[model samples]
Each structure stands twice: as C-alpha cells, then as structure tokens.
Target: MIDAAWLNPVIAFSIGILLSFKLRKISARVQSRRGPLIWLPDRWHDINRSKVLQPLYDIIKLFSKQTIIPSTATPFFIAGPILALMCAVLATLFVPVAGISFDYSFSLVVLFYLLMGEILFIIMGGISSASLFSAIGGVREIDLMLANEIPFILGTFALAITFDTLSIQQMMGFNILINPFAALAVLLSIIVKLHIKPFDIPEADTEIVNGLTTEYGGKLLGVLETARIIMVFVLIALFVDLFLWIPSSGALAWVIFLAGVIATGVLIGFMNSLFARFRIDQATRWLFKIPLLVSVLAIGWAVLWRYVL
Candidate 1:
C-alpha cells in the first residue's frame, strides 16, 4: 500500500504534467493549431492529435543534456534550482488533494512561506549565475514579487477572515458562493503567481531572453522546470480546495477535484491566449490597484458576515 506521505507528491506531480498538456493544447487551439498528440492511435477521422506527453518528453530531454555552469558563477548558483524545487515540493505536502490533507494548524501560512521561499531561491539562482540577463531577470522577478505580494496576502487574509481559521482543511466549503468577490481576488492573484500572460513580465522571453532562466540549462534547468510543473499543480489545487467545494471523501471526491482542476486550467489557458504580456509598470499598477481594492472589499464583507450581520 502506498502511504499518503509518499503518494501526495506523486499525485501533485502527475496532475501538474497533465495540466501542462492541457494548457498547451488550449494554447494551440486558440492559435488555430492542433496541440500535443497522444500516443494512442487516433480514429481515421481525427488527424493531428497533439502529443499528450510533450511536457514529460521535454523534461526528459533536458535531463539528458550536459550542464555547463559558468566559470564566474558561485557554488550557490548550483544550489538555487535545488532549493527552489525543494520548496515547491514542500508546499505540495500541505495542500489537500482528493479529500486528503495533512492536518496542521496553519497549513495555509506554511504554504505561503514555502511559495515565497521558492521565489527567493529562483532569484538567488538567477543572480548567482553571473549572467547579465539573469541578473536583470532576477531584478524583474523581485519587482514582480513586490507588486503582487501585498494583494495576494490581503486576498488570502480575506479568506482566513471568512473562515475564521488558517487551517486549510477546516476552511473547506463553498467559498465561491460565500464570497465571490474574495474568490475573484484570489483567482487573479494566482494568475499572477503562475506568471500567465499579461502578468508574465518576469519571464518575458522576448524582452529578457527567457528572463531568469536564460543562464540555466541541462539538469539545473530540468530541475527548475520540474519545480514549475509541480508548482502549477500545487497552486491550482490550493485554489480548488479554497474556493470550490468538493466532496471530502470517496471516489466522487476525486472526480470532482479533477474536474475542478481541468476547469481552472482551461480558464487560465484561455486567459493566457487572450492577453498579451504587460509591461512591468503596467502589471504592477494593475495588481496593486484593482486586485488590492477587491481584496480589501472582501475583507470588509467577511467582517460584516462574521460579526455585524
């Protein structure tokens, strides 16, 4: 029997890979092209099925390549991706999936800090790489982080206030129905966190030569990519658990949870297709202004519902 302690990470990573395939397909369709092809045979009527395992293949290819660290980089350069991946995996442990969660008093708080640590390690890796582009990318990442952090925290705080608890498991309910405004605020914050279109300024390949990852390659880059894949799953799962009320146990619970994840992935992929990347200042201003206001309003509503009303 697989212990949940061992199973959760595998589940999270598998979901992440699946989401990546779906997102790629969505993006391709939006551009009027067929996306990844599955290995299974398509019917004679259907040609050009996109590769479902494309993301997995890409990661494997990266892993097979040789790593060449820059002569100027410090030992810490090697540690960055390692630490970032660790943080992402650690964060996944706290998130509930398929009605199973680690019972901790402050899982949400721990998740937030772990996510921050992931970002921090990425920044450190970029800066320590000693590449000019990487340094710029690291700086841009910091800028993006500063701009998004407050609203994200405020949005999450609204949820905490609404549930009157920081324990992730206890916070489960129909959160979207309870407070659509807070839910929207959090959804937007997550889009930024995922670095989707418009908010993808930190890694704008056109502007920064793939941004912080410009200097990363081979196995190091592979580790970072794996971390990103896992992060995608973790973040989406977090949102689903927080806002979408699925059954707490049984086979139905897993079905509902997976359906929610796919729905969220489709929505995000559509958004990514529709929007162009925002400039740093534009992205920061938008996040700080509208999302912040919505989050503040959410907090107020939570207060009213919990106390005055």
Candidate 2:
C-alpha cells in the first residue's frame, strides 16, 4: 500500500486541469502557478477525450519529448527543479487531506521553510540556465520573494501566537473566523507566491519569454510543471487546513475540504484573470506597503486574543 498523502498531488493536478477550463475564459496564457494549465479552444477538444485531463496530458507530452540542456547551464540545472519537487512532496506530508497528514510538533515551521526553499531551488535552476532573460527572471523572483515572505511569515506567525502552538495537526479549525485578517494576509501573500496577475512580474511571460523558464525545454520543463501543480494543491490545502474547518475523518469531511480547496483555487485563478501584470517596483512596493500593514494588524489582534482579551 502507498501513503495516502501521495494522492493529494494527483487530485490537485486534476482540479487544476478542471480549473483551466474556466481559466481559459480569463487568460489564455500558461504563466500561472497552476492556472491555465492548457488553454484549449472550444474546437480543440477531442470528443473522446475529457478536457479535464488536459494538464495531465500536457505533462505526459513533455515527458515524452527529448530533454535539452543549454551549454551554458551548470550541473545544478537538472538538480533545481528536482529539489523543488522534493520540497513540495515533503511539504505535502505536513498538509492534511481529509484530515490525513504526517506532521510533527513543529511541522508548520518546517512546511514554510520547505516552501521557501522551493523558491531558492527554482531560482538556482533558472539562473543556471544562464540565459540573460532567465537571469533577469531570477532577480525578479528574488525581489518578489523578499517582498512577500514578510507577510507570509507574519500571517502564519499570528496564527501560531493565537493558537499557542506550532504543530499544524494541532491547529485545525475555522481559524479564519478567529483571525480573518491573518488569513487574508496569507491569501495575499499566496497570490504573490504563486505569481498571479499584477504580482506576476517574476515570470511575466509576455515580456520575458517565459521568465526564469525561458531556457528550459522537454522533460526539464515538465518537472517544473509537476512541481508547480503539486505546490498549488499543497498550498491551497494548507490555507484550508489553517483557516477553514475540516473534521478529522469521514467522506463528508473530504468533500468539504475538497470544496474549500477548489473554491480557494478558483479564487486565486480569478485574481489571475482580473489584473494586468504589475511593474516590478510597483508589485514589490504594493506587497510590502499594503499586506504588511494587514499582517501587522493581524499580529496585534493575535496578541490581544492570546493575552489581553
């Protein structure tokens, strides 16, 4: 028998692919973390094939293609996306699916560190591609990381303070009710993390020829996409686990959790459709200036809830 947690990425990839059908109405581009997995026109669908599986098919197509590496890229090029996928899979063990997860006392901390490390790995891989465009994309990713990591920490930290624990397994409930601000802050940070519209400067595909992915092709690119689709599921599930309600067992619990995940994922994809990409300076400035304040207020609220109140 295999670990139950292994099913999450598969489920998430399916959901992401289903979501792309809707996302196609918004942006035909595949620049999102999971949105627009494949933008098939109405006429492009095969009558026998379900479009919901298109993302899966896309990955399969890439896996079947030849792998190519740039002459300028270092040995680390192959390692980067693999390492990032490892981070995502590791993080999955900490995030519950229908209240099933393998988490420890400080797993929340570990989860975040892994998510952050995933970015570093991607940056390492992207820059190693040695294309000037890839280099610029890496810089943009670093800048965006600096800007958003703050709110990401603060929002989750606020939750830690309120719950008085760092174990994610011990912190399941409708936490969004207790601190909507923190949840909102985390949600905003996720938009940046996943590179939705406006905050998508890091991989502004139209302007940078697919940004950090500019130099990647074939199986290498497929690995990156696999990591991406998995992370989308992992992060959205993390949000639901932390901020929404999910009982410890039963099929109903799974349904509720899946509903929440789908809703949230769609919300994120909707954001991807709503705004044009932001300039790097504007994006970073907005992230730091705006969500930071909400996160600060969330911390204050957490302090009051945990202590004074």
Candidate 3:
C-alpha cells in the first residue's frame, strides 16, 4: 500500500518528463527532419558520445547551475519560480492519476482549489519579476485567461452537470455510457488551456524570450519548464478521463489516450510554427468570440441530449 501510494505521483512525474522529450521530438518531426537519435526516453540522448545518460545529465546540469536575479529585481524575483513550481506540485497531488486518488475521495475539490492557486501564482510571479517583457507577458497571460476561461469552465461544468459528479473517475465512468460531446469539449479545452498553439501568443518568443519566464535562469527556469511540461500531462489526463475511458483498467487506454494527445499537440505546434503570433489583443478577441460560442453551443447540445431530446 505504501508503494501504491507513491506510485501514482512517480508515474505522473515520469509521464510529464517523457512528454517534454516527446514534444521536442514531435516538434522536430513536424518540421520535416530527423532530430536527435533515440535513447531510453528521448531520441536526443545520442546527440553526443555522452548520450546514454543524457537524462541524468540534463537534471544534474540544470540543478547545479547558477540562479541569477537581475540587479534591479526585487527579493521576490529570486523566489517566484520556486513558489510557482511548489504550487504546481501541490496541484498535481490533487489530480488523480492511474486510478489512484489522494488520501480521500474529497481530494477532487482540493484539486480545483489548488489549480486556482497555480493560476494566481503565475500572475503574482510574472508581475513581481520586474521585467518589462515579463510584465507584458503577464498581461498577455491574463488576456489569454480571459479569452478561454469561460469556455473551459463551462465545458467542465457541462461534464460535471451531465455526470452529476465532479469526481474525475465518476465522469469517466459516465462517459463510457452516455455522451461523447463531453469528450470533445475536454480535448478542445486541453489545447486551449495548455496554450499550445495559435493560443500561445502570451509567451510568443518573437515578443518575449520565453514569455513571462524570460528573466528566470538556471534551475529556476528549469523548474518552470518542467512545470509547464507537467501541466501538459495533467491536462491530457483530464481529457482521458473525459474520453477513451476503459471499463476495466488497462494500459492500452493510456497508450491510446497519450497518442491522441501527442498527435493533437504536434498539429498545434506545427500550425504555431507556420504562422506569426497574433497581437495579444487580436488573440483574445478571436478566442473570446469563437471558442466561447462553441462552448455555449456544446453546453446547449448536451442539455438537449440529456433532457429536451
């Protein structure tokens, strides 16, 4: 039981790491060329003769590096990434993975609250960093929030309402028998919520080196990068619960679900690389209009299917 207790988080972290490596590979393949050669988790491991243990190399190199804070930046600047990462880890604790729940079933509600805290951390960390680019990134992040949040919330609410339960496991069980539209909403919202593509303008590289993360360096930056990647898996898992749910647990379900996520992410990234970032204002304007309408329509359709039909 103790091993079982630790297993879910370990798997979740491993999956998150694998996804980051996979994203690099997928992004490279999308550009029509082979990237680094394959190894245990990533093909990029064989880039040099020292490639066999590249994952270890990555961690050691990142963790041992210097964390630099700008001269003009406040004391909070040094601590912001750590705080954001802590919030991310705590949020993950609430997210049920691989049929494993936290200490109690009520942990689902805790997950929701923790997720909100992560968002708040992003806002605070970005603003407190004292960089012009970071501030702009913060504004764009908030704008992105305003644009897709309504759709996201309503989409989740639609699932919760239809299933009559906020617990992810219950929703997954219900999805197996009832509607597929909730699955559709989960897939679409994952893309938007992750800010994978066309929606990634908040941290557009052309405008901000790494968006709100421009100022962070060394290990601090690594934590933020890792957190972002972890979020990808977290969102993917949420989508899996909405769709591709299996009656009896099986590894195949996870495989199929992950494949779908990777495919969607690759497509989004390819599209993103092909186009220039839209102005922040333009992005929010379009997202608010199109996605919002689509979500409302989805909710209406789900209601009709459940009742008026």
Candidate 4:
C-alpha cells in the first residue's frame, strides 16, 4: 500500500500537472483551432469532449530533446537548470498539498529556506552562462527580486500573522476573510513574481533574444520550462489555500478548487497575452509603489477586523 504521506505528494503533483496541461489546452482552443488529443480520453469521455494533455506531452517532448550546451558556456551551465528544477520540486514536499501535515517539525521553515535556494539557483544559472545577455538577465532578476521582496515578505508575514505560526500548514488553516486590498496585492504580486508579461521585462524577447535563457537550449531549456510551470502550480495552490477553505475530501470540493485555479491561470494568461511588456524600471517602480501600499493597507484592515470587529 502507498503511504498516505507519499500519496499526498503524488496527488498534488498530478493535480498541478493536470492543471498546467488544461491551461495550455484552453489557450490553444481560445487562440483558434483544436489542439492535440487528450491523454485520457476514456476518462473524460462521456463527459466533456475536450483535449487536455497537450501541456504534459509538450513537457515530455522537451525533456527528451538532446542535451546541448553552447561551447562558450561555462562548464557549470549545463547543470544549473537541473539544480533550479530540483529546488522547485523539493519545495512541493514542504507544501501541504492534501491538507495532511507531514514531518511537521520542519515543514514550516523548510519552505522559505527552499524558496531562497530556488531564487539563488535562478540567479546563478543566469550568471554562470557567461554570455552578456545572460549576465544582464541575471542582473535584472536580482533587481526585480529586490524591488518586490518587501511586499512579498510583508504579504507572507500577513499570512503568518493570521495563522499565528510560521508553518505553511498552519498558515493554510487561516482563511483570508478580511481586506480585499491584501488579496489583490498578493494576486498582483504573484503575477509579478512569476514575471508574467507586462512584468516580464527582464526576459524581453525582442530586446535580448531570450535574455537569461539566450544561451540555453535542448534539455536545459526543458528543465527551465518545467521549473516555471511547476512554480506556477505551486503559487496557485498557495493562493487557493490562503483565500478559501478547501474541503478535506470530496469530489465537489476538488472540482471547485480545480476550477478556481484554472480561473486564476486564465486570468493571468490573458493578462500576459494582452498587455505589452513594461520597461524594467517602470515595472519595478509601479509594483513597489502602488501595489505595496495597497498590500499594507489590506494588512491594516485585517488587523482591525481581528481586533475591532
């Protein structure tokens, strides 16, 4: 029998993977023609006749590509992407996917630690590429992180305050019932955090020819792409837990949660496609100035709701 602990991670990963694929399918369908076949047609058959495996199949194809590194790239460049992917994957272990806390002793602190490492890995990968575009991209990432770190930390602290614990599992227990500004701030921050378009100035394809990833190709690109998708899933899960009370177990709850997440992704993807990329300075200034203030106000309101209400 599979251990319950192990089973939760599998379930969470599967959910994340499925949602990612579904978003891609939805995007393709929206863009105009039918996409590829769903991986499990029989399962969804007799229900909604829709394809859902394009994202997963695309990811698999990426991983199977021949590994190649530019001759001018640093020796460490080849391994950097894998390191980044590993850091993201490890983060999933710390997150309480199905609501069961495991290894509770370290689960709370481990997530922040892993997130820091993931950030470092990304910066390192960019720098180690030894290309000018990559170097500039690395610098841009550092700047972006610096600009947004305050709001991100404050928002996270707000969650900790709500739960009165640093543990992610404990944080999940606290529902976000107060302050629309806080939710909006965090929602916007997540978009910026993911560097989605309008905020994806650092990796501007028109200017830098792929920016930090300009030198990476083949399997390394695959690793980076997987890390990006996985992080997207993780962020959405965090939002769901923070904003809504997820049911312990039931078909309806699962469906509701899935729909909520897909809604978030669609909103984000639409924003990405519709908006033009911002200049780096403009993006940083805008996020830190207005959104940060809104987030602070949201927290203040939440505090009032807790005490004055």
lDDT per residue for candidate 2 within 153-213, as digits (tens), equals 9999898998889988788888988999999999999888888788878788888888898
Best by TM-score: 1
| Alpha-carbon shift of residue 45 in model 4 (angstroms) | 17
Pairs that collide, model 3? 37-43, 38-43
Which digits, one per residue and each the tens of the lDDT, describe model 1 over residues 228-299? Answer: 999999888888888896656788889888988999999999998999889888887888889889988888
Q: What is the per-residue lDDT of model 3 for residues 1-309, given as tens digits with 9 covering 90 to 100?
A: 353435555566677666656665666677787654464445544655423233435666877899887777776665666676676676666555655545443555666566556665766766777888888888888877767667766766676667666676676643633545555555555666676666777677876876787787878777776666667667666665565555455686556656655665565456545655568788878777766777686678668876787
**Which parts of model 2 have CA positions greater than 4 angstroms off?**
1-3, 6-22, 25-48
Model 3, residue 295: C-alpha shift (Å):
1.4
Give each model a TM-score: 0.95, 0.90, 0.84, 0.83
Candidate with the larger TM-score of 1 and 3: 1
The Cα error of candidate 4 at residue 12, in Å, is: 4.8
Candidate 1 residues lying further than 4 Å off, grouped into runs, are 1-3, 39-50
lDDT of 2 at 7: 72
Q: What lDDT does each candidate get? A: 0.86, 0.83, 0.64, 0.69
- For each candidate in turn, give its C-alpha RMSD to the true structure in angstroms: 2.4, 3.7, 3.7, 4.2
How many clashes (backbone atoms < 3 Å, residues ≥3 apart in a chain or on different chains) does model 2 have? Answer: 0
lDDT of 4 by residue, 215-288 (tens): 87767888787777777776776676566545556666566566667777777766765677888888888878
